[model samples]
Target: MTGRIVRWGAVLGLGSVWWWAVLRLVLAPDAGALEGAVAAGGWGLSLLPVHCAPKSRAGARGVARWRHAWRSAATKASPRPRSDGGSGPS
Candidate 1:
């Protein structure tokens, strides 16, 4: 279905973006390289920012909380099971 395809596309797109961000954050010395690529492609600004150093201990806590929130949200959004009464009540 079209909706299924769109959902898969969004999942794959976001996954790729996250991978690219991590690659830029870890491998590239300057985040500007990633930024320049974005600019060349006509995006006004790059999403890759230099995050080599943690801003503060609170920042780490914030990241952990955000992760937990996303996990809980995903858990809540998941579909419930259906009772099929298998094998036609055999």
Candidate 2:
């Protein structure tokens, strides 16, 4: 999932750069285009580098990092069927 997220993020980041060129230089150079470019770049492109960061990288350590830990934690907390005789969720 992280790989998928990072892939999407890369797509979005690249798209935003194209958007910047078309919006700022071609579409409307003086018609309040900065707001739209900023919006798309901020919400769509900014998160990409974080997800693409390596595990030991500083960007991957903060609270803003990916939520991969939650899955392992949840798995550990959940109960599983016993091999001897007990039955669990089916």
Candidate 1: list runs displaced more than 4 Å.
Answer: 32-90
- lDDT per residue as tens, model 2, 1-90: 999999999988877766675567555657466656665656675567654656576445555443567766777885765789766679
Question: Against the correct fold, how does model 1 do in TM-score?
Answer: 0.35
In model 1, state the lDDT of residue 77: 83
Best lDDT among the predictions, by candidate number: 2
Per-residue lDDT of 32-75 in model 1, one digit per residue for the tens?
Answer: 66644643443333445535566584355577888999999998
* Cα RMSD (angstroms) for every candidate in the order listed: 18.7, 14.7
